[model samples]
Target: MYAFVSVSHPDEIKDRKRQGKLRQHAIRNGIQRSKADRAKKDGVFVPVEMEGKTTVATKRPTNTVALTKAPSVSLMDPFDTLCGCPERLRSLMRHPSAKQAGEPIFCVEDSGKPFFQGMETIFRGALTDPSLFHALSLVLSLAANNNLPNVEILQHRGEILNGIRVNIKGLKGAPQVSTLTAMLLLIGYEYRIDGADCNTISMHIQGVQTMMKLCKERNVALIDEVQRALFWQDLLSCLMAGTPRFLSHRDFSDFKNPIGIDQSQQWQVPKGLEESMMHWPPECAIVLEDLNALCWIVDSECNPDQEVLETFPIDNTQANLESRLMDLLRECRNNPAEPDPWYEACILAAYICTYKLSTGIWMGCYIPEICIGQIFQVIAKIPVDAQYKPAPALLQWVLFVCGGMTERKNIRQQVATLIRERYPDPTQDPEQEWETLRTTLKSFIWCERTMEKRIFIFWNEVYPELHTVDSSRNKMLVV
Candidate 1:
């Protein structure tokens, strides 16, 4: 049944290229010194001032071949070559027609996770550069079929690395943008190839970071797509790495509101949500804030721009939030006394929210299912009839999201029954009933990346016929 419906984001991941000349010259692609002219150290960066602006310059290799006019860095460098793969193999990487989401070639199960939307084609080859073509092939193959032999995977990986190394071996400035994409693709490949067996993606991630640094410090501009890909990889990998995020200091996630959130007047919570949860920790609050912003961005249905990246750089925003939750979950379990059911439930709810918008291979492959299963055990500790004194709104959000994420039919029915028990459709204001539910969802976190049809199934059951006229819009099921 393809349990979770995979969605490609509404916006296409277009090439982001900005051309500007370095202070010394007025070229559209910016200030790039010819390799032969780069007389300083081969890999060391030296500051160079031009037109009153200071930019870094790299020392070049001893033997350099200088072109009469340096070519501009294009994300799609179609003429680039050096991938030694035979034509038979190269043919496999080429798709004659564009495949829609959920097709055999467009597999994105855990790859899309909760909210990693609009990224279906990132691993698909840019088809411009040969090295990148190989990298994309490996990632595409692994994503399409996780059970491919390790030996085959390693051979393809080696070829990708060798091709990239040779292509950028003597470049004076940053590696070509397609090479940057390939590097990002390799990180994605390693992550998929090795679940938690090892952390091979770490070195690959650091390598791309180095390439990005070369571009920025030297006034070399990379395509916007590559930078965005870097942030996404940083976000997913950090959860398992347990190390501080690679893009730690580069966060810009703080925007109270951006655009496209249609709700105006929020419905009054049936209970005092804020007053009751005075005991909640600061970390919980931060995660909720991050989730709320995510809800807005997802609801906006727009491509994630600089504002969204800065505000919700998963590397820091989600990684730190998950780390804090881990600590809290551990402390709660290790306490000398019985854990606070309310506190435990709250964090578990927030923990579930972590996957509501994004899902990926964390410490455990497909950890979303495992973590959501544990949620029931915690909820069991609380009596069914008893109200969560901390906040009922929080509980409802948890039940609905947890219900959508759970694949088990009986468990989902149990969740739907629980939600109905609290807010029955017997109310005189049935329209208001549905409105109130969406209001609460928005107040916390909700996005289409969430299991849409599943959530709507629960909603239709809980409050029959309350679905809006446009409810069928954006149906997520693939089969």
Candidate 2:
């Protein structure tokens, strides 16, 4: 009778109702309280409700630290703090001895708006990322201390390499843009540190190629102006180093026109005269691409078969490209009384590349004296201040071509002095290389034979390592 009369207590009913409400609230919010919450509720410490906020309090009257909500955390990047002050960045970029130093072959214009924008983005990201910042700082310090003795230079170089290693290791998990930019900075750093040696630089470029492939797979488009500039820089680096291009044909397929050529097919110089040489005709890119491809073919360990050879028109292709380049050069030369030194230098570089491709020698059928003289004339007319504004690689290559071809002792000495004064790096030798090249040129001059034929004979007899073609093959004359 007692069991039958038993009924649920009012407090138990209220407790059940509150439990159901909590379940419903958790379901609605898609958040379930963990076992820890239950354990906390069961402990001596009880949660006190004040207004709508719940704060925990201990039953034991022991002294306890009051807990208040922490201030909201700021997620702003540290680099952003420095972004508003560009003067600091400009100071960092400007060479300390820019005024005292004679016109450098290349000088970065820190005050330029475009440079500021580009650097702002780079510096912001670098500052936000510790590894990147370290690597960049080390490289900048190395540049600043370039005049230091070999021992100190080597120490900084090792630090930079360590920083690069750390950054590269972190790249595996980094965001796409971050990885790409970091790799670019590393590539630039290597170029500066080691000059044109492709040994290390190619590794960074290969990494970029892998990243680009990943971006492609993810359907990420990298067609912005900054990316385009980076792409061009990578392309030019590969061309100069004689390495295979990182960007495949498909990489550029998205471009309506690959080289930005219009319907007219006329060469368009950039609007700013200062940038004309910096921005070569899109055609130059195409030609450089072809040249790079040819270099790969020539340097490959496995020789291509007739079918593979036919796939790319490497034979006599250089002559055709060189002809087109010469035509463009003539057009530029005819435009005005004062020729653009940068443009002229670029055209001359194209000529040198094509000539070297067609015939395995620095000088082609073109008269060395005439070509050398023209380069010097154009260089003399260029304003000293403006002369330093062009890219060092372009100017260095121009000087290299001129130095390699010049038969005059005085002119050769002048080019050597220029190289020593402007770029003292041994790897970027217009001096040491000139010594070897001068002997070769003199041998050809004495034999009254073109380098095309004489190079094969010289290599077959004296230097087999420098030979690219078979000594028995007469087909090398196709160019």
Predicted candidate 1 versus true structure: per-residue lDDT over 116-176, tens digit per residue: 2334354344454667667655664553454253565577788788878887797787677
Q: Please, what is the whole-model Cα lDDT of each candidate in the order they appear?
A: 0.53, 0.46
Give residue 75's lDDT in candidate 1 (0 to 100): 17
Best model number under TM-score: 1
Q: Candidate 1: where are CA atoms >4 Å away?
A: 1-130, 147-150, 168-172, 197-199, 240-243, 249-277, 286-396, 405-454, 459-479
Per-candidate TM equals: 0.48, 0.35
lDDT of 2 by residue, 247-312 (tens): 432344333222222234433332222244345566655554444444444444223333223344
Give the worst 10-residue stretch by lDDT in candidate 1: 97-106
